[model samples]
Target: MSLFVTYVLVLGRSLESSRGLLELLTPALELEVDDSPLSLSLHAAAIQLWCLVNSRSFSSSDKILTEAYSRLRTAIQDPLQRGCESTVLAALLLQRYERFSAVWNQHEQCHVHRNGALALLRQQKLDGINSKHRGYLISQLFHSEVNICISKKISFQASEITWLRDQDLSILPSNPSTALDIIGASIASHQHKFTLLSAEEFITASKPDLSQWYQDLQDTEDQLNNWPSTVPRHWLPQTLQSGKHFDQSIITYAGYSDIYPNIQIASIWNLWRTYCLLLLQIKLALLGLFPNLDEPTGTTQDPRIPAFKVKSVQLAQVLVDSICQSVSFHLGNYIEPTSLSELMIPTILCTSYHDMDPSHISYTLYQKSSLFMSRDDHRRHVIVQGPWHMMGTLSHVLSILADSESHIPVHALREGQMNWVRTQFLRVLRLLRIDLEDLSATNQDHCQANPGDLHALNTVNSEIIAKRLMAALAG
Candidate 1:
C-alpha cells in the first residue's frame, strides 16, 4: 500500500542516527530500575550484549557475541539457579541478540535462545514463582510464540498444547493481550491437534470422541465472537467503511478496515484477524470445503466447495483490509512527532508480504490475489516490497523483479509523492545489504538442511531494525 511504503521511507531515512534506542528500552524490557532486576552478572552482560547489537556498531558484533555465548554456557551449567526471574530476562534479551545478528544467527540461534527462555519460565512456574514480573514475562513469551507459529504455519505439538492450556488465565480481561491470551490455548489445539490433516485421519481421530470434538469447536467460535466485547473502549478499534475516493490498489479487499490508537494495538488487531483467517481455512476444511482427501485424484468434490470460496473471499476481504490498516500505522506519515514511537515498528509490517506458505494452503488466501498476474497463473507480476524492504537491492530484485509480487511499491513511487524521502530510505536499505543477504542465504540453508520444515523462518525484527524503520522520519 502507498500508506505503509511512505511511512517506511520516512522511518528508514532516520535509522542510523538513533543511537539512543537502547536507553528507551522496548515495552517488555521497561523493567523497574530497582535491585529486583538483573542482579546477576550474566543478566547484566546479556543487557550489554543487547545494547551492542542495536547501536549499529557491527564492528563489535562478533567479538561481544562470542563473549555472550561463553557466559551463557557458564550460566546454564547451574540448573538450581536457572529458574530465577533474572535468568528469564537474561535469556529473553539474548533472544533479542540472536534476532539482531541477521547474518549468522539463522533459525537455529534465535530458536535455541527462545527455547532457553521458555524452559526457564517453565522452571520458574514449577518453583512457585508467581510474582507479577513472572506473569508479565510469560504473557510476552506466549505472544512471541503465537506469532512465530502463525507466521510460519507450524502446528503445535501435543506437549506444547498442554503447556498452553495450563497457563494462568487470571490475567485481567481488560488487558489488550489478554483477549488473545485467553483463547490462545484453544487456538493452539485448533491450529494443530484437532486440525484436518486429512479426511480419513480426522474422521478416525474424532470417532472416539466426536461429541467432545465438536463441543470444543463450538466453544472456540464462541470465544472468538465474545472476545471483542470484553475489551476496554480505548483498546477497541474504530470500524470504517471504504469510500468512493479510496485507492483500490491499496487497501479494502473487503469494504472496511480498523483504526487503532497506536501501532501496538493495531498489531494486536492484525494478529487476531490472521488467526481468524488461519482458523477459517481449517474450519472450512473440517466442514468439507476442500476436496475429500480419501477419494481418487480429481474424483470427488465437496458440494460446499464453491460456496466456501465465495464466503472465504467475503470474510477474508475485511480481514485483509484490517491487517493492511494495521501495517499503515507502523508506516505513519503523521501519526506522531516523536522518534521514540519508531522503535516499536514490528514484523506486522515486515511479515505482511508473502507466498502464503505452501505448507498451509494451495491457494494464497492470506495474501491479496492482486499480487499475481491472474488467478490461473499465480505468477507474481507486480512490484511489491519483500521482507525488510528496508534492506536494499537484493530485496528489490527478489520481491519486485522476481516473486512475491504486487505493484504497491511501484505505485508508491510513481505518484512522486514521497520523492524526497525515498533516497534516504534506499540509503539505509543499501547500508544493511550484507545483513539482509546473509539472512536470506542462511534461511535458504535452513530450508535445504531441514527439507520441508523451516525453524527460524520469521523476520528477526530486532531493536535495530525497528530503530532503522523509525529513525529517519522527519516531523
Candidate 2:
C-alpha cells in the first residue's frame, strides 16, 4: 500500500518536472527517432497525459494537451497508414476525460473533456462505427458520463442510459434472467431492458440473472483443447493412490508438467490476487465508498469447488502480485539499464484495461432461453449477464493457468503460453490491484460458510477497481 502511495507521489512529482515533458511543450514535439516500439510510445503518451492532469498550472498542462491533440489530428489525417491509429486516438480521449474531475459545471466552457467526450461519442454514432475500436469508444463514453453523473449525485438521462443498455446488449454477456417483463405497454415501449432502468428495476425484474453455476466456458474449451496426453483418466483417485505427492498429481491431472507447478500457479494466482488488492488499496487511498455486493452464492455441489471459490478473492489478489513479479522478473532479465522495467507497469495497465470488455463473454449470452422461445430470440438478450460473469471468467482463467504447463520466461514464451497472455492474464494485471483480494475473499468465505442461491451482483471492489483504474489514467 505504501509502495503504491509512494510510487504515485514520486511519479506525480517527476511528471510535473520531467525534461522530456517540458520538451514536448516546446514548439517541436519530436517522436523518438529510433523505432522504440508502439507500446513504448503509447506508454509515454499516457504518462505525459497524467502529468498534465495533475498539473497545478493549466498553462503548463495546455502544452501537453495541444501537442497530444495535434499528434492525434495528424494520425487521423495521415496519408500513410499507421499500425495503431485508433488506439492513439482512444488513449488521447481517455486522457482528456481524466483531466476533467468527475464533475460538470455549466459555467465553464463545455468544449473541454466531458463535452468533447460526448462529441466523440456522437461522432462515432454518426459515422456508424461498429468495430471493436468503436465498441471501446462507446464504452468509454458511457463510462465517463456515468462517472460524472455519480459525482454530481444526479439522475442521468434516460436516453443515455438506453444507449448504454442497448450497446451493452450487443457487447455484454446475456442470460435468461435479463429477459424483459411486461411493466406496461407504455413503460415497456420506453424501456425494454430492465438493466437500463434504475436500481428499482433490478428489484422488479423477473427471473433475475440465472445464467449458471460454473466457471468460464471459454476456459473449459481451452483446457479441453490444450489437454496433455499424459494426464491420468482420474485426477483425485490417482493422486491419492500415489501417496508420493498429491500436489504433483493435481498438476498432472490438469495436464501441467512444469518443474515448479506450485510456484507457477502461485505466481499466476498471486498476480490476479494482487490486482484486486491494488484496486482496494487505491479505493481506500482515494477515500471512496465501496460498491454493493448482494448477489447470491453460486450453487455447486462439489465441495472442492466451493473451497476454491471461497478463496477466489484472495486468490485473485495473489495472482496480481505474481503477475507483477513475473513481468518484472522477466523484464529485469531481458532489458538493460533497469530504468525501462518500471515502464512495464504503465504499459501493462493500459493494454490490459482495453482487453476485459463485457462483450468478450459472447459465448454464453443466451444459455437460459425458455423452451418455448426460439433459438434466435433477440428479446431475451442482455449485455454482460452481470459483473460476476467477468469474475467467473477470471476464475476460470486462474484454473486454466493452474492446470497448464506453459512457461513464461523473461526472454521467450513456451507453446500455449502466449495464448493466456494474449487472451486474459496480461490484461487483468493492468486494470486491477491488491485490495480486490479482501472483497473477493469476503464473498468467497461467506459463500463457503453459508451456501445458497446468489444473484450475480458486483462486490465492494468497484470503488477499489475505479482507483486502480485511475493509475492507468495516470499512465
Each model's C-alpha lDDT? 0.40, 0.28
Per-prediction TM-score, please? 0.52, 0.28
In candidate 1 the C-alpha lDDT for residue 130 amounts to: 34
Name the top lDDT candidate.
1
lDDT of 2: 0.28
191-281, model 2: which lDDT tens digit per residue? 1221233366444444323112012222322332233222222110111111232122121112221111111122223323322332222
- Runs in model 2 deviating more than 4 A are 1-91, 94-115, 123-133, 139-162, 167-325, 329-475
For every model in order, what is the number of clashing pairs?
A: 7, 45
Minimal lDDT window, size 10, model 2: 378-387
Q: How far is candidate 2 from the true structure (C-alpha RMSD, Å)?
A: 19.6
lDDT of 1 by residue, 1-475 (tens): 1222222222221111111112113322344332322323233434333333243344444554555566656666766446555556656655655544543222323466668777766765534543445555565566556544433335444335247566555532235465575565467666664334545765566432544554576677777767677654545555444443222322332344344333334445555664565555555545452234323445656664556546655565555445444432233221111222233432122112222233433223323232222311110111112212222222222222111122122232223222212322322343233233423566535533642231234334222332232222100
